[model samples]
Target: MTETTENKDLVQEENVVTEETVEEQAELTVEEQYEAQIAELQAKLDDEENRHLRLRADFDNLRRRQQLDREAAEKYRAQSLLTDLLPVLDNFERALQVETTSEETASIVKGIEMVYRSLIEATEREGLQVIQAEGQPFDPNVHQAVMQEQDSEKEAGTVVRELQKGYLLKDRVLRPSMVSVNE
Candidate 1:
C-alpha cells in the first residue's frame, strides 16, 4: 500500500475507537444523571417528612395548651361571684360572735345564728372553705401576716390569732387569712 493510503487507514481505525469510547462515556453519564436525580428526590422527600413531623408536633402542643387553658377557666369560673359574697359572710360571722345580754336578745341571736349557719352551709356546699390560720403554722400562701407578736409559748412563725377570716374555693385560695404571727 502507498504511505498516504496506509496513514489514512490508521487514522480511520483511531476514529472508530474514539467513537466507541465516546458512546460508552455517554452511557455512563446518562446512568450517573439518573442516580443523581434519584438522590436529590430522596433528599427532598426526607426533608418534607421532617417538616411534616415538626408541624404535627407544633399542632399537638398548641392543642394541649388550649386544653389546659380551658380547664383553668372552668376551674376558676366562680371566683368573682364567690369573692363578692365574702363580705356578707364575714358580717354573718361577726353577728354570731356577739354576746347576748338578755333572754330577748338571746332569742334574736339564736335566730341570727340559724341564718348564719344556713349561709355557711350553703357556701360550704358551693366549695367555700375557711382557711385555718389560728394555732397553725403561718404560711404566706394561705395567710397574710398583718402583725407580728412576741410570744414565749408559741414558736416563731406560728399563727397567734386570725383578725379576719380567709377562705378557699376548692384548691385555690380566694383570700389569704389576715393573721398575727409569733415572732
Candidate 2:
C-alpha cells in the first residue's frame, strides 16, 4: 500500500481501539454508579427501619407506664374515704371505753361494740390498719412528737404514750401518731 493509505489505516485502527476502551470504561462506570445507588438506598432503608423500631418501642413503654399508673390509681381509690372515716372510728372506740352500770345501758353498749367491730372488720378488709405506737420505739416517720417526757422506766426516744392513733392505708401512711416521747 501507499504511505498515505498506510497512515490512514493506522489512524483508523487507533480510533477503533480508543472507542472500544471508552465503551468498556463507560460500562464499568455505569455498573459502579448502579452499585453506589443501591448502597445509598439500602442505608436509607435501614435507617428508616431503625427509626420505626425505636418509635414502636417508645410507644410500648408509654403504654406500659400508663397501665401501671392506672392500676396504682385504682388500688388507692378508697384511701381518701377511709382516711376521712378515721375520726368516726376514734369516737366509736372512745364511746366503747366508757363505763356503764345499768343492764339496759350495758346491752346498748354491747350493740355499739358489735357495730364498731363490724366497722373495723370492713376497714381492715379494705387495707386500713392502725399503727401500733404505744410503748414502741419512737419513729419520726410514723409518729408525731407532741410532747416529750423524762421517764425512769422507759428508754430515751421511746414512745411513752399515743395521744392519738395513726393509720395506714395499704403501705402508705394516712396519719402519723400523736405521741409523747421519752427523753
Candidate 3:
C-alpha cells in the first residue's frame, strides 16, 4: 500500500484499540451497575429511618398531650360536684341568719355546724379552698374590693374586711373574694 494509506490504517487501528482499552479498564458491567442501584437503595433506607424517627417523635408528643388531658380530667372532676353544693352552702348561711337560742334550735345549729365542718374538710381534700381575705393585702387579681374604710391601725391599702370568700383550683382562680380595703 501507499505510505499515506498505511498511515491512515494505523491511525484507525490505534483509535479502535484506545476505545477497547477504555472499556476494559472501566469495570462497568452489570455487577458495577448493581452497586449503583445498591447505593440508591441505601439512600432510600436512610430516608426511611429519618421518617421513622419523625413518626416516633410525633407519637411521643401525642402521648404527652393525652397524659395531660387525663390529668386535667382527674383533677377537675370535683368542679361539677362543688358547683352543685353551692346552694347547700347558701342554705347553711340562711340557717345561721336566724339568731334564736332555744335549746332545740341550738342543737340544730350545732348539727349544721358539724355538717358544715365535714363539708369544708371534704372540699379541702377535693382542692376547694376559701381565700383568706381578712387583713390580707389587697390583690386585684384575686380579691374584689367592695368597700373602702379608713383605718389608722392597719397599713393603707390593706384589707380590713372580707364580705365573701374566693377559691382556687390547682393554680387557677375559680372565684374572687369580696373584701373591704383600708384607705
Give a tens-digit lDDT track for model 2, residues 1-183: 699999999999999999999999999999999999999999999999999999999999999999999988988889999989999999998999989999998998999999999999999999998999989999988999999999999999999999999998888899999999999
Kindly indicate the candidate among 2 and 3 with the higher lDDT: 2
Superposed by TM-score, candidate 1 places the C-alpha of residue 10 at a distance from the truth, in angstroms, of 3.6
lDDT of each: 0.93, 0.94, 0.85
lDDT of 3 by residue, 1-183 (tens): 799999999999999999897887675766688898999999999999999999999999999999999999999988888867766776786787787679999888889888988887887898887778888889998899999999999998899998767787656667788899999
Reference-based TM-score of each model:
0.85, 0.88, 0.79
**Highest lDDT among the candidates is held by which one?**
2
In every candidate, how many clashes are there? 0, 0, 0
In candidate 3, stretches whose alpha carbon ends up further than 4 angstroms from where it belongs are 1-12, 21-42
Give the clashing pairs for model 3. none
lDDT of each residue in 1-183, candidate 1, tens digit only: 699999999999999999999999999999999999999999999999999999999999999999999998887787888899999988878887889999998998899989888888888887889999999999999999999999999999999999999999999999999999999
- Full ranking by lDDT: 2, 1, 3
Off by over 4 Å in 1: 2-6, 101-108
Quote the positional error of residue 154 for candidate 3 in Å. 1.6
